[model samples]
Target chain A: MTSSKILPAMPLLAAGLVATPALAASVTITIPQVKVAEYHRPYVAGWLEPVGGGSARTVFVWYDVKKGGREPGTKWLADLRSWWRKGGNTMKLPANGVSGATRAPGSYTVPIPANLPAGQYVFKVEAARETGGRELVSVPFSVPAKGGSASGKTELGTITIR
Target chain B: MRFRTVLIAAAAASSALATPAMAHRQWLLPSTTTLAGTSEYVTVDAAVSNDLFYPDHVALDPAAVKVWAPDGSEGKVENPSKGRYRGTFDVAIDKPGTWKIGMERSMIGGTFKLNGEQWRVGGRRPPMAPGAARPSGAAPAGAAPAGAAPARAPGAPGSAGGQAGGQPMRMVASVAEIPAGATEVKLTESLSTYAIYVSADAPTKGVLTPTGKGLEFDPVTHPDALVSDEEAQFRFLVDGKPAAGVKVTLVPGGKKYREAEHAQELTTGADGMVRVKWPVAGMYWMSATTEDAKPSDKRASARRMTFGSTLEVVAP
Candidate 1:
């Protein structure tokens, strides 16, 4: 039974990759006017999720989790629950692959995977205050057999992300 | 073929059942004590109970270590030399007072699984000066000076006569004088945690003074009200210029949601002061708007002016 199941499943799994595109794909998220007061910069998280279900995979994370000596733990990563449960929760280091420094209110861009599977995908942008509220902004995009680019925006009230 | 299949299934079942139960036990370990008032070295050791249980070659995640000096100064240890399934850190202590060392371990990789835990390195009692007799005065060995009660040492034994448990060692006591006209505020008593004291007045600002060891401030933003009393007396400057009648809004950080509901909004006073009582502790982002203000002619005018500082309030 196992041999029969494996023999048929392997071809289907291999065929599933036929829809993947080989173009340089990218998604840029811009948040404008992030207000930095009291030396506290904004913490931002970016990720991609399947259109309907499954998991959210993080593509970027930015924050100053270190003070003079205090370190931010993986537990704190849970603060970005939507991203943590999807992508960060499974990786050895959340900072690896998708890490950026905490930035003042301004425009920032992240490159998406060029080899993303062709499908309807949702891009999520979530910004949290180290000392304030959380805002989750999402934009939907599609990856064709040929990869391309997509963009989105979120207004954080004196803060903007495009 | 059927017989071979049955045999393979039996072997698989036995192998699964025979798998060993493994426990990972990696903990932060530091020297028991260091001589006070000398160039004494204190070492932090990370050890695992069993080599088979060791997860990975331990390395100090530079951001995880917080070291506080006797004089209130703080510094972080960023690098750790790797040992066989362990890590060792040698630190220099140059003053007399309690030195607090705190560390957290991360489980990077391996078959054994261990969740991270914060561990303190030093004992409660300060390392006594070599050959110095216990104070001859009537005070107890660990008692604070007259008119001041000594803060309880971390991990200290419950009773005075309790058996000397292997708690982390601390340094000898040193005088922490609240500068003239400054009131001492008692923050939390946890080791390596912030214990802040400030002057009891409006526009209060003071710096921590470390006696010997260097002090480093936590860059992470603390709750805003932690520094000032609620109903803060704020001074507003727009574009580096004092502006009156400016509409201002204070936005709290995401972590500060609990306190955001209570943060007050105020207009700049005639003197550019915006006083509002803070209802909770957290980070706040204040934005002031001036209707018709133009860019200043001065070179400094081009610079954007915004207050970015963390405030911490401690118990008195």
Candidate 2:
């Protein structure tokens, strides 16, 4: 719905939306053990959202990796609210380097294509369990940037981006 | 990869069920919707109450709650504890913009039968979250609250069946989807979301960006300036525009169980906005719904789209 008041729009203090990579930057995201009774492997989605406002590019998704049939975990990707809203709704699954099976509570890394340009960008990771709890974490960084680390106290653990 | 695409298409087939719906009423009631200081924090009470505004349902933990700050970072609730009727936690607003806090997207689903029997629960857990009150109706007689000790046995309403103490909806798990002669009845997939806005200052952006993936309410007023004494308008946008003919509901909170008993229903205007007000502010929620012209491709008997949100109206 459009607002008619028509005031000068406030600029959105953009999240860490940033750059293109010159080489494949290997980033590791860790999923920590939550120690809950109903512990289900989380459906994870990570991507880079441009701070200047453009479509978000998919980084990777982790789900029930073993299922190859019709009723795979693919059905619930939308449960990852933030990612699904931005692009998961129309995303094609099993992107060669961007999709993989759900991992254990350990560190996993993916090679991010290095050709992306240098700029500020937000690296987003969202996780949702089968029992209905969900969480999202975004790390603001710049391309051709230094590596840093952040963690989600609830759903995820240390994330190291170079 | 082609095989994965087929599997994804299959999942996309049922993704319609993931669309937003009024599966349950989750309220994110905050002590105040407007915070003036960057270091100040507001207390929020989140709950899944059957009686509406009453904290008699399940309790949620602070860790399960998430807060997206105005600057696009995750905000955590501090000192989360179970209150008498709701889950209480504190959020610190370090920026001067709109912050989003609520329970993660939760789904409650089960079978509905033609035999006049039905069952459901809050979120995905069969047992209510720890420290919340027990289920009050006849259903609790069969199973114990989940996560609780096996204080009792499982059986239908006083039957002497063996106890499955921690499973609250044991019987509910058995109802078959569309049992014989149940053409009119069907399996239900209910999705729920609870988000409350805290405006530390005038919010010009990000307060009402409709995801368009589900039923969503966008505020017409500057979220930082919402006042309980005045009526405000919220728009129910479907497909990113004003949705006409949608049902908008406002239930003011004060007395226990009074909200459900005295809820008001209004239809959206030609512009898809519903004007709502609070007589006295406490913790209030607004929910809206719309029906599609055709059944979902899944051929479910009835298809509906729902949107719900928690509103913390403050005094002038």
What TM-score would chain A of each candidate receive against the reference chain A? 0.65, 0.79
The sequence of per-residue lDDT tens digits that candidate 1 reaches over residues B121-228 is: 112333333444331222344554522423433222111211123332222222221112212222111111122121111111223222222112221122212333
Best model number under TM-score: 2
Assign candidate 2 its CAPRI class. incorrect
Over A1-162, each residue of candidate 1 has an lDDT whose tens digit, in order, gives 001111122354465665534443444445556345643555677777878677677777775544322334332454454454345545444355576556665554455656667787777776666566567666676666222333333334321212
**lDDT by residue for model 2 (B1-316), tens:** 5544433333222222244232335566787665433556788776655456666655555566788887777888898897544688988877767888865342333343333534332222223334443433323333433433222232222111112344333233322212233323343333334567886544535645777654567768644455677788778776677888888766767656353356678899889887776677555667677765333235344345666666655443
Consecutive 10-residue window with the lowest summed lDDT within model 1 chain B:
B105-114
Kindly report which residue stretches of model 2 are placed more than 4 angstroms away from their true locations once superposed.
A1-162, B1-25, B50-54, B104-185, B256-262, B277-283, B293-303
What is the C-alpha lDDT profile of model 2 across A1-162, one tens digit per residue?
111111111221131244543554656778888788888889988888878888898888887645645445665664675675466655555666667777667767665557678777788888888884677777777777655668888788877676
Model 1 interface CAPRI class: incorrect
